[model samples]
Target chain A: MAGYLNLLLRLTIWFLLTADLSWDNLLLGVTIAVLLPRGATNPGTLKDWLYTLGEVVAAIPQAYKEAFEIMIYPHHHEAITLERAKPRRTPSLLFLDIFLITFTPKTIVQHYCEQGWYEVHRIQRRPTP
Target chain B: MINILSDGCMIIGLVFWFWGTWPLLGQRSVLYKLHSLSVADTLGSMAIVMGLLLRIPHEWPLLLLALISLAIWNTVLGYVLAYCSTREIGHDG
Candidate 1:
């Protein structure tokens, strides 16, 4: 099945990244790859993987833009509260979102507010249209 | 040539590390300080690891792991700290 293949691919990558060909290390990586994806509410398909990869690639430039903005204009602090339009976000997606936003220096999610709104603290407020 | 590139990456990483810290001295809110520190820390650490990756290509496995860990754990820690602070404020007031 697709899921099994995905798991195998991830395990292989993990093995390479760890660069340890020992039995113990290989066992650990296999255990993790098998166990973790099983917990995902929706296991990733090839399309999903490709889409996420594209999103990450696109985000690189945006991240750099935000980082430069933070470095150049570091004096101001603006609190912008926004609602999560989506009905629900998976833990994985939420964590990914947080990591992506926080990786850039401009914004940080301070608190998950009532009514599905998130209190995001920002360095610069968006301009009014 | 490789040494020069590695040194350059390390120097740039140090610059990012300092840039992230310079905001801490300011009278910013807790969230603001956390944001600056986390961003700088993550990027700087990754850059340093990248320099190491370049300096010793054979050790990339370890350096890559370091980079990935820095990205994941640093962001998670920031979120945890922010959540705790919010909870404390809610409890008191």
Candidate 2:
């Protein structure tokens, strides 16, 4: 399917670029490709393809700035006292939001199944609504 | 000579890819194709950068920026792809 092919391509690209196709990297890439939102409306038209391309292109600078910020300052934020609060809402922009946060240092993607929520764990928590 | 060789090698990689890889895989899947092309773009530019770095040893700052930029880009792409894929496939359905 389109999804599988994309996974293969992403893996091949990473292998080609880094000159480090160790088993570890290959396994990691395979794991990621398999984990990607598959069948979530595969890009079927020229427009879809263009949109995906633009998304990737847009990720570069946003990621860079995040990296810069994390590097200059590494501190933790407050924690979520209550799990059900909308303040703990998952990112609305989905991939872009996920990319920005993970790209920033000291933050990780933690999946909480008790509430079935995916939250960003920052160094420090921010005031929530 | 180095720049020429670098360009030539990249071209060769492209050729090998189009001729050898594409036909074998069948390029109908847009996600797959884009993923592969992302790899190509990342590697293709990386090679050119590396070649330039080798040729110009004095521009350390520029080289450092290039390396950092690429690293950040790659990491972000990986994270986005993983998170989006997970949420889309796992919880959405």
Candidate 3:
């Protein structure tokens, strides 16, 4: 039920943002058809789900901080501390991904390695960019 | 006002297009070409819509609805088309 609701909400948001009835109707019908069989994926009850949401809320800040450090605004001094920090072979995608991640509020890419591993860090905002 | 902005945007969109279209200059894969074209179309249409918005005075609601619909359709169609082309061509990344 929760998953169904989540899908519905997502689809509605997509519909509004995009304003395409064809895409919106197709996606909505598909979501309903698929979700009817599987129901929900949570192993726990509703209360447990709520608690997990709380945990996720707490983790967001740390994730954003980590992401920022890894991908977006890394300290040059810290780069010295981290000796393994070599240039990435795929700089274009890495840079683009970081820019996209950091462009959003409360998210930052952190600890970006040449191996394409990234950690996301989150932080609270005070309105001024 | 919207007309002027739209015209400016259209000009910029054309610049992206000219750079993206050439085989020799871009040397980009089919997928990248599609992506660039998608960007160009979106930006170009935005400018055209801006011009329409300025010129058409009334019916703001309908105009906006049409604009949003067109943009969404364009994006989804371009993405799917490009994806299909890239898959067929077997371009790596």
Candidate 4:
């Protein structure tokens, strides 16, 4: 039930973004939304999706702050290796994680290894320690 | 009042766009330059779009699409460019 609803919502947003209420465009949006790969069998409830959206919105200020810091100071490049420990890594969750992390100017995912590790490149001022 | 806010956003966006370029001329690695460029470009573009959105509220649908595209495609492009550079280096060595 939730999956279908989610699909409908996405389709609606797609239509709005296109600003075309024509039948053909509406059908196309529905087709594309249906054809796209969904995350998991049971993605999540609407509340969960709303929570995630809120988190993303809250992070915007932090992203802007980091961008300003990088611009103002000399930053050194470093790669932070990370391992994904989650047993069930949903595609949607992974995509969201990558998008949020990269949205910030301070860090970007450089590589994702098949061996379950991610090479994230970050820029920061040299530590005083 | 709205005009003032929109102009402020546009000016800040332009500043960010120009700020990103300064690293290119410095003694930084390709990755560093790419990092600065992508970050500034994304934020600056988004800011400019926001300004436009405020100025022309009626055309928000297109502007919103532009913002989404900037967020998604810019990050993907950065990853692709970095990956290609690494592959090229591996080939040479």
The residue-level lDDT of candidate 4 at A38 comes to 73
| Residue A113 Cα positional deviation in candidate 2, in Å, after optimal superposition | 5.2
**Pairs in clash, predicted candidate 4:** none
Which ranges in model 1 have alpha carbons more than 4 Å from their true place?
Answer: A1-18, A21-40, A44-49, A85-88, A113-116, A125-129
> Could you give the fnat of all candidates in order?
0.56, 0.08, 0.00, 0.54
lDDT, candidate 4, residue A19?
98
Interface RMSD of the candidates, in order? 2.2, 13.2, 11.8, 1.8
Per-residue lDDT of B18-64 in model 3, one digit per residue for the tens? 53344225664444344334434543454456566667756455566
TM-score of each: 0.78, 0.33, 0.37, 0.80
Model 1 pairs in collision: none
Q: What is the lDDT of candidate 1?
A: 0.70
Q: What tens-digit string does per-residue lDDT give for candidate 2 at A37-108?
A: 754643344444455447756755554344335334532243322233223322223443444444433343
Q: Is the docking of candidate 1 incorrect, acceptable, medium or high quality?
A: medium
lDDT of 3 by residue, A9-76 (tens): 45655555555678667777567656655533443344544544455445434433442343344221
Model 1 / residue B86 / CA error / Å: 2.5
lDDT of 3 at A66: 41
Chain A TM-score vs. truth, each candidate: 0.60, 0.39, 0.30, 0.65
What are the per-residue Cα lDDT tens digits for candidate 4 across A1-129?
Answer: 468766876886797688998999988998999988876665755665566567778767877788888777768745555646234444565666666767787777766676656667777677434
lDDT of 2 by residue, B1-93 (tens): 767775675664464345323523674332233333333444435545666676676665566467556645854664555446546655766
Which candidate ranks first by TM-score, i.e. highest?
A: 4
Global lDDT of model 4: 0.75
Q: After superposition, how far is residue A117 of candidate 4 from its true place, in Å?
A: 2.1
